[model samples]
Target: MNRIDVHHHVIPPFYRDALAGAGITAAGGRALPDWTAEAALEMMDLLRTATAIMSVSTPGTSFLNDTSAAVELAQRLNDFTAELRAVHGDRFGYFATLPMPDATAAAREAARVLDNGTADGVVLLANSNSEYLGTGGQGELWRALDERGAVAFVHPAELPAPEVEGVPPFAADFLLDTTRAAYLLVRNGIVRQYPDIKFILSHAGGFVPYASHRMAIAIAADTGRSILDILDDFRSFYFDTALSSSLAALPSLLAFAEPSHILFGSDWPFAPVVANQYFANGLDTGVDAANLAAINHTNAQVLFPRLAGAPITTSAERPVVRLRHTTQRAVARALFKLVQPGTN
Candidate 1:
């Protein structure tokens, strides 16, 4: 029953203020939810997530022209999450955000955060400019992560292009970004060079499950090596059971990945239908309960050994505190009002 979530989102006060003059339809416009520390803890209870490792959800300062501002906000967000870990006394952990689109600034933040032992890992967007994750010299960021065999949770973000009228930001654009980033790593050899870093792919490895056949053929045509042969790079990589844990995806994932390489992800308020979606579709009964604990918390201990461990147990060793919203956290309800982006 030791459950932990490796993928969750938080809106820092900095980015919230930056969106003021920006119209709802700016480049790959993002919607704001009434996200607050209190509401997040409550959602944790409903989702049965004992501890959530939060990260910089999309718009990780990739759009901002001011690189310094991006760096400042990134540090502040890290500080805030670390404070949450401090306040909640180990119910949460976080991935550090870096100001992408600027290699030097990003390198500085990653080095500082990880070296200080503040972050569990880093959450990198698929692209910061027109360049994808492995392109634009972004490999340096991964190299820094590699030095420590750290976790790299690759979450999808909207492409910085004008919207294609019918396609909502949440549609194909996000999926495409995830695919492009993963493909870029393979092509650019970043995944090959930095084999030490553990990369966690979001949204059930994006569309890679369905598209791998075509990609495999393309690679076979060029390199004479099967794409699945190359997928071994991802052997060290991890997959989070986010919204894609539903029927359409779980089967493919089961067929593709060993369960130990799989982890839990809620995608939280944005993908609220996740848990029920899996429930309605049914989960793979073969999944290991102990491994489920690993997906939830144990493996994270492997990732961040310094992070707080198992919750306090009762006389029967049962987790008496489970996921209830403590009275102290409920006081945060004053600010956690629901808003747009349609509830998750």
Candidate 2:
């Protein structure tokens, strides 16, 4: 199946200089990954990936407190991606980075990127330094995304100070931040307010599958409020499998959300190198084929029609029906039946 990976990233040299100039390093103290487009494409080629929509890495835009520097950095990253996309064509598209603390500038940057057609849409931190981003000053930016039917890749940013056990910062805290943003967007009426923009959450929708009951309870406790109202709005959001291809996580997602909304992502060029192995190996997994390919590539194309180049096809394109989940024996039988010359 041809796949259009919507959650891949590219950290250009200018961003490295910016981070180093500010003495900033690491993500939650983990070393910052050294990202390059060349290595990214190599990984994609190896994975049979057709195209990847690139976003700037974390601590970007967020680290630059100076709005001007943030603007300059964003422009540089956007331009760099434009050049990459130009060279690679649709195989490499980009989501724009914005200067967020200053919402006005953020809105301006969104316009600059989208209006110029330099990017497909915008990529924003889910939580801007500890607070949930709702339909507030950020609304100006959302409005632009909504107006253009743009793709908004909402990656969870640095979580609040508290870190829970049994799950490290990246696995637990980052995932928790993602759930928090999902809630803010759906239950808190942000997604309801801005329905036009497509929202893509990272790491398999974070803690949503585990914590969805809590969300239901939150709705029930507020009995006066409509129950399960947010579920519909949430269907609008997408999730990527990054650091979330675990036995515990992936199964719950299959149980909870449909595979059509789960996309594949590999945060590459991880500084230590061993990390990238973990990311790539997760793909040759045991998830059901229809759903797995959808997660890997098909769903992304459905969401962003512009990514039509992905080689995979979905039930959406054909009259074929798919089973939600099935046993390995059944899949093997189906595979055998399809390969037989006289099966028809």
Candidate 3:
């Protein structure tokens, strides 16, 4: 199957060098991997990934607090990716990086990148400098993206805590981090308000699908909305299978997400070649041919029509069908009331 990998990553040379210069050798408790355009292309060819939507991995520009530096770095990275897309148009596309936590700077960069066609969309870390996207002045950034009806790819970053004794952050903490961001966004009602902005959650939305009913229950209780209403909002976000195409994770993702919302992803470089191969194999064997075709490429084409160069057939274009967790409302309401004492 021809795959359009939405969750693929790019680590630019300058960014890598900057990290090394700052005496930083790792990100999210893992050592950074070496990356090159030639290497990425070779791997894509082997893996049958037709196109990769690239973005810089975590510890993004927010690793530095200076707004000026952040702006410069964001520009430089977008420019580099744009050049790559220009040279390798068929094989690569990119999500523009923005320096967040400084909402003003982020807004400016978002406008500049999207307006100039330097990106297919933008990639945002779940939290930047302990400031989650749903908090503080991030509305400016949201407004900017919403204005253009932009696609915002959400990736996870390390949480604001030291690593636990033996656990690697990427394996577990990253999941929690992404979950936290999703929770805050739902709680803040950002998803409903910004209907135009398509938020693509990486790593199968980081425990979101499995825990969505629970999340919806909490939101319902807090906002005085019905469980069903909250659940609908929770289901609206998009999910990408990066390192999460295994049997353990795929079922929940497939059940909770809209079929049209499940996009293919290969979190390359960071997720080593073997790991990528493993997940690709899992997806190949695990899903039915029809669903697999959508996850592989068609779903992504729906989100990014620019990637669809050839004529799209009707069979390949599946209408988005909303799938609900039948037991969620009854179970969640009981749990919510049980946890909150006399709130009901």
- Specify the highest-lDDT model's number: 3
Candidate 2: residue pairs that collide = 2-311, 2-312
lDDT of 1 by residue, 97-143 (tens): 88987877887888898898778888888877666787756666777
Alpha carbon lDDT at 228, candidate 3: 84
Once fitted onto the true fold, the runs of candidate 2 whose alpha carbons sit more than 4 angstroms away are 162-168, 220-223, 271-283, 310-344
* Inter-residue clash pairs, candidate 1: 4-296, 272-344
Pairs that collide, model 3? none
Compose the digit string of candidate 2's lDDT tens values, residues 1-344.
46576778787776777788888766644567667666676666655567888887676687766778888888888898989988887678888888876678878888887888778878888777565667356677777778888778887777767655545466467777788888777766777777878888887788887677678678556644555665555666777777666556777776777557788876554422233333434444547777777787778877777775634422223221223234434544553453353673
Q: Give the TM-score of candidate 3.
A: 0.89
Least well predicted 10-residue stretch by lDDT in candidate 1: 314-323
Measured by TM-score, the strongest candidate is: 3
lDDT against the true structure, each candidate: 0.68, 0.70, 0.84
The predicted structure with the larger lDDT, 2 or 3, is: 3
Per-residue error for 48 in candidate 3, Å, reads 0.5
lDDT of 1: 0.68
Candidate 1 — which residues are off by over 4 angstroms?
Answer: 24-30, 223-228, 273-291, 307-309, 312-344
TM-score of each: 0.82, 0.83, 0.89
Alpha carbon lDDT of residue 272, candidate 1?
45
